[model samples]
Target: MTTPETFADLQIHPAVLQAVTDVGYETPSPIQAATIPALMAGSDVVGLAQTGTGKTAAFAIPILSRIDTDNRQTQALVLAPTRELALQVAEAFSRYGAHLKVNVLPIYGGSSYVPQLAGLKRGAQVVVGTPGRVIDHLDKGSLDLSHLDYLVLDEADEMLQMGFAEDVERILADTPEYKQVALFSATMPPAIKKITAKYLHDPVEVTVKSKTQTAENITQRYFQVSYPRKMDALTRLLEVEEGDAMIVFVRTKQATEEVAEKLRARGFAAAAINGDIPQAVRERTISQLKDGTIDILVATDVAARGLDVERISHVVNFDIPHDPESYVHRIGRTGRAGRSGTALLFVTPRERHLLASIERVTRQKLVEGQLPSVEDVNAQRVEKFRDSITDALNAPGFDTFRQLVESYERDNDVPMADIAAALAVLSRDGAEFLMTEPPPEKKRERPDRPERERPARKVRDDLATYRIAVGKRHKVLPGAIVGAIANEGGLHRSDFGHIDIKVDHSLVELPARLPKEAWKKLENTRIQGILIDLKLERGGRSKSDKFDKGDKSERSGKFKPSGGKPFRPKQ
Candidate 1:
């Protein structure tokens, strides 16, 4: 058997091949290119590849190619380490063979078992199940693998780590001897290699080149925001961005639909692509996106693969991806064909370390992106309104509309500007108007500060500074910041001033010499999903830079400034 370079080069069934063509898979992986030919010819295979390298498809292609659609009994079995991975693999099977009309089911714990038993009784051509759930089905006689011709051990190392190795071994023992065994693992640890030596017979070996993740062309960016203000931030982003198309990625399918619904409710052309969509409907939604009928697509990582719409110039990770490779793939949906694209990741306070891990993996700094100013959003909205009016006036029947407006104005004793203002107010969809004045182009007259001027202090050097990890995106009001310090940080409202919140961080001024007990209490508390981060102030930097590494409050050296006592809040 020879290696396959493309999906067509493999001996996949005509139906599955058609499905692949529909799903946009052109090239196969190095492992897939190497192992497909042998597996299609009924030889066992042992493939070693790192995570997020498309290892699922290397074996899936061959097994689906070999399954007998007419028999309907299970002909292929895939064992996964976790329920999430199991469902993800099962979805891949369905998406690749939906046009072929094959039934694929994923069995796992923490989900209803009756549906799985019923699905197996209905004759599944392929079954992907986690260990405990699979064994449960096996004992109940609801699942039969006697006729199985192919078996897949995916992420075997993870399964063993999760204490599923014994169950997997038992499953392998129960599977028919003539079955083709395809084992894939990221590492060849002794236990895994021993299982490989025992279960697979002189298997063809294939290892895909694990490319350097550090070289991924992802321009990672994060906006520090609180949970409550996330929707507002996202809406503001949608209002100002000029992407050709965008996909907002979330962690869950429900999140995909929820975010999509919110965007649609705001009148954007958006849709959700998830596991729950019917195959035909999903194809329709994708076709619309590819052709520009849709502008924003909300999808999970697994549901978004092969979504190679070249017009997609933006990828918004509504939540940070679980792993760096996933970040690569999610953003990889954009930035294709040598075009520059933008990827914005939303990082919660707890998820900052995850962002750091991604940076360490990819070796890139995700520059911080500012949440669009209310002025920016208002400008965009006004421009859009102008464009809409322009479109209407440019139409053939606008002369009639003009005449009607003139007549109404004459009869109603209204000035044209008044009518226009009314229309503008009517056009707004109950959103609050931004009334703050933009700064003048040139500097206005102001008193010059001394070159040696000290930073502003609250109440004659009674000021102390506390860093909070929250910012504008959390919908945290200035009053909330003030109150948190007053009630929680044990400072009076008059003792705080010059509050500022950048996208990922916030800062407030507090009395320098807080009561000893109050300072001690403030040191350990968090506020509004952010660490209170109360500490003495020394320097000034960008709001983002100030808390970039978090606050520097320590236990021993920590004290009130100017020989004052440590402040502590009461119980």
Candidate 2:
């Protein structure tokens, strides 16, 4: 079969093709070129491709091309590993099907069920969700898969690694046997092979290997920034950067607008574009960007997919992407057509791992970027102010202002320098022309000393205790509990205190006051397919007493596997 060059050659729906054109994609990617035709022909597909290889569009375009928009039954189901990826995929489907009025819903844990239930009730043709939440909705009878035509398991390897294997199997069991399943994973492990062997029916395999290197024309760098200081850091960086035009990539639609609004308030000519924006408005925004009406454009990854503008000399990843493929795509927006460009990534302390992942995938180490100091910003402002004066002196106008300054100095017997300083202050409009020294960093207060140095038996009020329903019988380790909570609950290791595993349950100490987001995530957190059912233990036996009086049987360090085999611990 001849490889298709353009999206128009793929026989996609006109509406989807137009949307793709609006996004500036003229040619189909290798994955899309190969996988779309197979999916459209009613064949189960196994796409072996890395993230950021346009996998979403490969399946989404074909699904949209064949979807019956008139039938509101859930026709397609896409399962992703994380909430962020689910949301991203849902957004892509929505953007591509905007003209068709397709309803795409994203369901995930760590969020309220009210909206998802309502969306399902209203009948979204396409449903995207994490495995756990999808199972929750399915068991509740809110999600119906009887009419499912397509099922896509994206990042299957990552999902399996995150301990969603059993959940994935359960979901697959619920789907209709006749459904066309498309499984996309970077690496086909033994487990994934087992799944394919048992489930998929003579699937067509398509593989696309990305260049394991970043573009040579782009200079990559990153700044370690805290969440609260991101806006300040961005403004300072913009003030010092010498780029003609730049694009700031954020993770969500709301963030695109929020960042753009903040940038505009800081005197930048900025605009925002996301999937929610109308096609006409999006086109106008892109046109403005190209014609130099806007200098900084804040956009999401989907919104910036096919955008190619020569004026864009810089790309700022305001929110680090969830995967390395996305990082490559975000930076690729700049340094296009063999032009030299700069890409800046903002990595919060918690996102250092993601930064490392990008570095490993791109095979290029990113230089650490330093935030402009207060002195540096102040100096830039002073230099710009002096240049403005130089330009005014050379201009033909401003004669009246010059005469007034002279008259004021002569009449008041004041030095011309004092008059000029007073005028300069007025020109600043109540804002300081030079910044003051930054405030000192606040020290975190600890009671009695650090947790490590403190006595383990000490029960501090700052640490709250919680209980979970997995223990030695389940072969659950303290590290497992910590890993589950830290990854799913979004809690830091320091946020956890002591973990004491009992025969059937475990007790853990956490901060007394947890962030609202973390608290929500913990509510739905699971360990080895069992919901933790986390509940605060306000009145329990003292932890020290419980530790001193341990159960003899559990202390023997012996356990039985679910297969009824006695397991002995290493000495």
Candidate 3:
């Protein structure tokens, strides 16, 4: 198949083409080049591409081009997995269809439904929503799909994984029989294949394979450290690395703000971009990053998509992503436009398996490296200090300041050298001139040591165990539990301890002195649609007295837990 050189080459409507140009899209991506024509030809399409491949516009442009502005009935419906993604898609459609005068409405949970009802009443031409809420509207008969001419499923695999397959099927069943359907997924699993076979008719398949060869100009490295030491290590690296701009990728929205605030407190020009920030402010933050006002940006994966800045010279993975594809996408923000960039991955000891998985997928071994030493940080600081003085001397308006300083020196009968020394001290303020000493390393068993002779692990005196109401019965996994708590409580994954899952309850260890606010939030948090009802476990007895006394053996490493599971620390 021949590739289209630009959006215009695809023969899109002039109005939509002008909108695309206004949005600064010069050329179509591979997916856009392949899928746009098929979609515009009134054929069902199956798009296979990864994130950040410009898939939104591939479908949006065609839908906008084909919409009948005179007919206000809903002509197209797009379903996404998350509210953030749904809003993002809606924004894209609005941007690309601005000149076409098409009305696009985004309906999702957590927002008032009044606006959605009003939009439907006004006869919106396009609707974008999540599957569950879409089903809710369909059940209420408030949403009309009889006139819907096109249905597009964005992130089909993610929707299915979020347990929305049945909802998707039911929603599809409500639409007209002749309505065109399009499915876009990052990976085509068996479930997705089944859906395609059932819903689509001779769909035009377009697969855009990701570039397997990792960016040759990008240097990749990894550092092994515990969770408590991550902030210090990151600060040291920031001091030494020579980058015009850097992006730090964390796992949660809360972490983004916390990390950015901490960095700013430590004297770095940093800000955060997350879902909570208003769209206008997010754009302003990006503008600041581009213009060199903000040197560091801490962001989550969802908020950082489509972020293209030529000044981004480094990408730091503050927390490892859950999947290899996400890791690739996070690092892909750098090393763009044929420029060299640096990618740093922070891995705990227990997360080595994830590190290996990333290497296996990327087909490149990352170089193991140590954090910058205190001496290195001090040296860099001294260099920066000298450069600042040199710049001040070369500045055009320094004569007035120099005369003032000289006058002060003369009035106080102070020598010029002493005056300079005093001024330098004032400039330094109370900030530390050197980095703190590195934390002591934890000891581990040697490969040659006999199993019986190895030392027993030391018990943590600072941690306290708590019992939660939901467990194996609710189909909760260790990762899910950890993720929920860490994300909601603003704690790191490594902050968790042993997680013992029982038939109806689970025991999780966490820091004993949690903040009152975090404790309250944990009490109200839910897992798998079940309320946590978290309570402190005192002397092997829960506050509710639900746990069996005999389970003490299981908790103390005597009798093995279910499935012969040994006690393993949380990653």
Candidate 4:
């Protein structure tokens, strides 16, 4: 039989084909073209394809076509290596089968199991989950594969590499022999080969070779910053870096919202999108990005799959990806169709190894990025302030304000320049026109000296010390503290000063007078699964020492957005 060229030509259900058409996909990718037909024939199939090769749809479309949605007994099971991928696959299934009203459930670690248990009880036709979570459900007798019609092991190589081989086998052993299995992997290692040999019965093989190289038209660079200071670094880059529109890639769904909120607080038009967001909202946000309503999008890896925006001039890896494939996938979001794009990576000291792995995999060395100096940022601010002035001069309805200023100048016998300077200060909205404090100099590395012997970080006077109830005993790290504070308090690195970890607790330096809401959130924030119980240090002088004890309606301080027009995508 001749192979099908279009998705409609395949044996896909009309609903699935219609959904594909709605997504503007008329042609199937190589992997999709090959694997979908084989799976539709009720044959076990093994697919070899790299990341971003339409592998998810390759299996999802066929699986959805064959789903007995009316049965609603967990007919299909897809095993993924990570929570993000599981959510991605679940979302794809949901989208593809929307017309058929197929129920898809995604379960993973680091999330509450109550929802999963409830979902399983409510009944879903398709269940996509991580190996560990799948095994957990199997142990609890919540997942039954006895009547499963389709079994799929997506990213099988990554699952094995992440030490889930035994869990994969355990799940495989529990499934009925009649289940049609589909295993997809980027490479054929012994571990993956063994799983296919023992499990898949007369499986047809499909291999889709990658048609393009990694980041050919992309310029890549990395900035080495401490964990707590990543936000500070990111802020400086946003101020000085030249880009039309940007997509910041973070690791978690919560981080997407957190980072986007922080960016908005700093006067950037930003939005967050993730698997947790409703599909309608996600689509609307993407549409806004395309129409230049918002210039920056904060997203997780899975949430950004299949995203194609021609105006995205920059891609920022706010959190370095876990694998090289993810790094390639992220950078590929920009620099499309022979266009040049820039990819920036933020690397902490501990994540240098991951950076090295990515460099080796991509066969390209990432140039070290130079953080914009204080003077550079000040110059950018000055230019923005100048533009604001020029805009006021050209805009109507400013005649009254101009006359008022003129009268004040004449009445006080003040020079026009001095009057203008005073007015500028008042018009700044509490943001500094010039940065006074320079960033701390990076410490020199000494291969000859041990880490314990390095000099202690200097504390700045602007920062007030607070104590948190986590330390070495709790196995706390600086990154954990930074992530907890940034994610929970919505505070950035500029709001932090220094950290001194002790045995039972740790001392962290923060803004002397924080907003009441932030203080309350920080007090209850947990690090390493323990409440931080953050408190102001005794004898410390500040505008308010009564943490969370003051009037709830009042706030002591807030970070101010800089004066400028919100960023817009270039036409």
Q: By lDDT, who's the top model here?
A: 2
Q: lDDT at 88 for candidate 1?
A: 84
Model 1 C-alpha lDDT per residue in residues 388-480, reported as the tens digit of each score: 576666789888967987998999989998887776565454433432333333423657789899754422232445567778877666755
Residues 1-571, candidate 2, lDDT per residue (tens digit)?
9999899989999999999888778998899999999998999999999977789999999999999999999999999876657878998898888789789999986677899999999999999998878988888999999999999999998787766787899999999999889999999999999999988999999999976677899998899986556777777777566677889998656568777776665556789998668989999999998987777899987789768898888899988987788888888888888988899999987779999998898888899989988777766566556656867786786898889888998899999998888987765555555655545646546568676684547454446788888888888877667656755554444456788999988999976655566777787787876888887876843322111111111111111112222212212
Q: What is the TM-score of each candidate against the true structure?
A: 0.66, 0.69, 0.75, 0.73
Deviation (Å) of 35 in candidate 3 = 2.7
The local lDDT score (0 to 100) that residue 501 gets in candidate 3 is 93
Clash count for candidate 4 is 0
What C-alpha root-mean-square deviation, in Å, does candidate 4 show against the real structure?
9.0
User: How do all the candidates rank in terms of TM-score, highest first?
Assistant: 3, 4, 2, 1
* Tens digit of per-residue lDDT, candidate 3, span 1-571: 6889988899889999998898788988889999999999999999998766778998998989988989988999999876767888998988998887788998875456799999988988999997766876898898999999999999999777655676788998999999889899999999999989989999999999765457889999999977666777787787667667889998767678778877766666789998778999999999998986787899988889879999788899988986787788888889899998899999977689999998987899999988878788777656655655776687897999899988998899989889887876665454445555654856645567686796755444446788889888898877667655754454555457788899999998876655565676566566776877878787743222111122111111111112322222111
Reference-based TM-score, model 4 = 0.73
Residue 247, model 3: lDDT of 91
* Candidate 3 steric clashes: 0
Q: Kindly list the per-residue Cα lDDT of model 4 for residues 1-571, writing each as its tens digit.
A: 6777899889799999988888888889988888999999999999999887899999999899988878969899999876667878887888888788788999876566799999999998899987767877898999888889899999898777655676789899998888899999999999999999999999999998764357578999999977556666777787777676789998756568778877666666789998678989999999998887888899987789889998788899998986688898888989988988889999977679999998887878899989887788777766666766777786787988889989998899999999889887665555555655535756657457676796755544446888889999988777566656753564554456677889999988876766565776566566655988988878654342211121211111111122335322121
**Best of the candidates, TM-score:** 3
Each prediction's Cα lDDT score? 0.70, 0.79, 0.78, 0.78
Instruction: Give Cα distance to truth, residue 261, candidate 2, Å.
Output: 9.1
